[model samples]
Target chain A: MSNLVFLPILIPLLAGAVTLALWRSSRWQKRVSVISTLVYLIASVMLAQTVSEQGHIVLQVGGWQAPFGISLVADFLATIMIVVTAVVAFCAVLYSLVSTPGTHIKFGYFPLLHLLLAGVSGAFLTGDLFNLFVWFEVMLLASFGLLTLGGERAQMEGAIKYVTINLFSSALFLSAIGLLYGSVGTLNMADLAVKLQDVEQQGLVNAIALMFMVSFSIKAGAFPFFFWLPASYHTPIIAVSAVFAGLLTKVGVYALYRMFSLVFTGDIEFTHEILLWVGVLTMLSGVLGAASQFEIRRILSFHIISQIGYMILALAIFTPAAIAGGVFYLFHHIIVKTNLFLIAGLTQMLQGTYELKQMGSLYRQRPWLAALFLIPAMSLAGLPPLSGFFAKFLVIEAGITSQQWIATGVALFVGLLTLYSMIKIWAEAFWKAQPEASGKDISLPLLGVIPVALMAAMTLIIGLYAEPFIQLSQATGEQLLTPATYIQAVLGGQP
Target chain B: MSALMAVAIGILFAASLYMMLRRSIVKLVMGLILLSNAANLVIFTSAGLTSGAPPLLDKVTKEAPVGVADPLAQALILTAIVIAFGVLAFSVVLIHRAHEVVQTDDLDQMKDTDQ
Candidate 1:
């Protein structure tokens, strides 16, 4: 049971290898990838269940001691993330089977998907900062492969920008880890949690913390560092974009949440203050960017930046309730954002264009598509009786309690702007009576609709039955706030 | 000696940043290489300057050698260098492919998606 953490990382890695071996046989690749993700889903659920009931589970690779060897630790926060990764990865693979062109599958799309899952899992579970960097590289390489799979001109352009920026971030991440290891003399996170408290060189520590902040902010698609995101995110195949938007930036947020909570809490006043302003700019600019875009995917790409702002705002506040709100938002945004991209893809399939001016009759021709799209889109806009409303409400409540009035105001304004852009999408794409041209084709199989509908159903389920999810996030947030428990578990309760 | 390596790392970082700011995609790849090597050098120097002594422990007494280098830093750098090499290789190929498709190396002209 305690070995479940390793299973999530291992299954995808093994499946990726299998898929690569069977790449010539697309049938085998699909079978292998789907079964592997299903197995991962089951394992992650078991891991989450065990962590919820039992405490954090820690495994030192090769039976080495915690500080000396690589450690894989599954705390509540990590387990929930792994579970979410499993669910999203499952939907993404199913959608890829129908949406990804045959040329892409030949280029090893399934294998790359599994490799990305392995990377996300590794990032969530590693107890050492260096190990985290390795997992990031794993994810970067795999995403690069997927980004350029089809070899299209637009995809290559997007891939070039994406690759350049991400590689630069990787360099930054490495340098930060090196400096941190030099200053603290250890890379194990739990050990750093204790070691950093004893260091009196406050300025140096804070400088290194800022380095981490910038690196992660870029990854999270936050403001002042989000130019690459909107430039490139829309160029990929829908399955690729859906998974990337859902899980990639969230990994960045999770890293921020982890480091700030565990190791970099020495000078929260300075570090988190910077984070707060970043949140404000990111939210305002991201939504404003969305409003100005005419392409459907372009709008959603910008919203990814905007939504990242909300999570950072919660993190900047750094209260337990605020962190809980951030966690809830993270889960909600992954499902809703991914579903939006999937719907946009299906819309392109049926409506014959990605431009808002040319798109129409989606609701009239396929009311069911409109309904499915509405659930997540409105949820994204924080409409009542949907998941997004509760997510934004919790964060705003936390802000109000903490007297963060300006940020609270900004958060509310962003929600309204979010609704405006979503309505823009609704009116332009769905509610419009018809386009000027009558020759537009709307032929799409129901196979591609399954993943979108499934994600929408999840949004509805979580929105209506919000209690259990809220409790889980609260528990996850509680675990994040109290780093001592994590340290104790990883270090065998050693002082 | 370690201070000298630190100076070199700083120089490398500055050079790479300048290169990365250029318009040419190939130069951008060069910058990425230099930047990654700079990071690896930082890791190497951070473990301190060692006089190339063996890090092995004696079987007879199980005592570690004096002035021996910390092998851990070397190990970390080795891993980083490998990862960087993989990324750099992929990046070069990506640049080449992108150049083939778009027919230009200037990143400014690659503005098809923003509109």
Candidate 2:
């Protein structure tokens, strides 16, 4: 059981190292990377199952007890995140294998992908704040590598801006950690929760919390700090872009959920208010940007910013149902967003361009492909009977219950704009006429289609049978709202 | 010793911030190195400045007094240094690529790539 807890993090890192050493041999690197990620995916699934059965799995590294050495806790929320990350990462690996095998970035791509997954998974599972910062850097460095792999004119230009901004963010994160350690005297998150409960006048705590929020908000691409995301995200290859678009911002969102729910619960009034306003502003800006977009992938990237607002709004509400809805929303958005990007990538392949202005009559040439694109697009637009609807429904329901008029209205308006933008893509790319088809026809291989199909099916599955996930999310929400569970786990049942 | 180390920390931070504001990428890299070193020094200073008081205990006592250096903080700083090294390596490669692909060392030339 303890071994299962660490396997998800360890396998990917070890495999990543091996991939690097074997980089000159593509066959060995590919084999090692795929096998390692598959092992990680299986471990995450098993860990999720164990959490469902046993409630939570906690392991203290190197036999050091919790609250002393770093500990990894596989709570329902973390396990679910790991499972989702593994699924999306696996799809990315598969997609890259078939689509860009001979591209210049192919040699070192798999290793970095594995390391990124390892970092993300480790960040989710760790119960220590400083460890979280380390994992954040680990993931950020790998992502920088992945982003700049091709060394193209556009990629290098974008990577510089991306790295500079993120390095600044990492500095801020370290400073925040320094402040947190100075004030709290312990870097363990669960211990900090306990300590914070006793600290009078939470001014310092609030200050640190705000610092953490700024660092994460920049990564999550919230309203004021989102300029870096849209500028750099669209410059990379689609496989890298798809995984990043799906996984990276969610890491920031994940940290926000962890910290606010656990260590900084005192100033609900100020924190929740700020989150609500930021969310609404983020929604408005993202939708407006999407409305004015020419490229298909860029439109989707902007939509990601808009959709994040809904999830943050859920946290702002600060209710069990609301947190559950946010969790469910994150789960749905990851799969759907990744699927949409891959489909867009395929469209780029067929038409030799990513601009919607140049892409049309896709449906006429490839009817099934158009239909495949519609499922996630409609899902993104909050069409019923898809997972997106349920996620949006719960968010709206939570807003209504909280009676936050602005958030609820913005959510609805954003949903409509989302539908409008998705429809614009559908009409322009699929229904309208194409000036040139590039070729008479081109058939996509199974590897290309399978990943999209798998992600779309997972989205549909979650929507149709949301009972188990809803139950798990409810449990996670309860644990988050009542963080005594985490504190107890880390402090060894200490009150 | 602690006071002297604290002054050194301040100097490192000031120098790093000055370099961070410079327009050149090489200076930016130098700035990051200095800033990371200063941060590690902060952790060291906070742990205490006694060079003689090793954190490891002799046979006399399993738990050291408050005067002893904190091994925990030292371990953390070491890990942070390694992480900083990784970041530095990545930055070196990325800057090289930027110069190669964009044909410019100045970030001002890179602004046109923005949406």
Top model number, TM-score = 1
Judged by DockQ cut-offs, the docking class of candidate 1 is high
> How high is the TM-score of chain A in model 1?
0.98
Model 2 ranges with Cα > 4 A deviation: B1-22, B41-53, B56-59
TM-score per prediction, in order, is 0.98, 0.95
lDDT of 1 at A35: 92
- In the range A1-495, model 2's lDDT, one tens digit per residue, is 766888888988998889889878877777776777788788889888888887768898888886888989888789889999989988888888777646643558888888898899999999998899899998999899888877778888778778877877777777677767766678888888888888886888788889888888888888888877877888888988999999999999999899888888888998878888988999899999999998898899999999988888888899999999999999899999999999999998788898898889999888988988988999999998888999999889989998999889989999999999999999999899986666656778788899999998888888789888788778888878988777777677666
TM-score of B chain for each model? 0.93, 0.88
Q: Write the per-residue lDDT of candidate 2 for residues B31-51, one digit (tens) a residue.
A: 888888888887767655577
Please write out the lDDT profile of model 1 over residues A1-495, one tens digit for every residue. 667779999999999999999979999999998899999999998898888888799989988888989999999888888988999999888888788888889888899999999999999999999999999999989999988888888898888888888888888889888888888789999999999999999999998999898899989989899998998888889889999999999999999999999999998999999999999899999999998998999999999999999999999999999999999999999999999999999988876678999988778888888999999999999998899988999899999999999999999999999999999999988998765756656577666888888899999998999999998888888889999999999999578
| Colliding residue pairs in candidate 2 | none
TM-score of chain A of 2: 0.98
Clashing pairs in 1: none
Separate DockQ for every predicted complex: 0.81, 0.50
- What is the per-residue lDDT of model 1 for residues B1-115, given as tens digits with 9 covering 90 to 100? 9878989999999999999999999999999999999999888888777885869997889999678888888899999999999999999999999999999999899888767
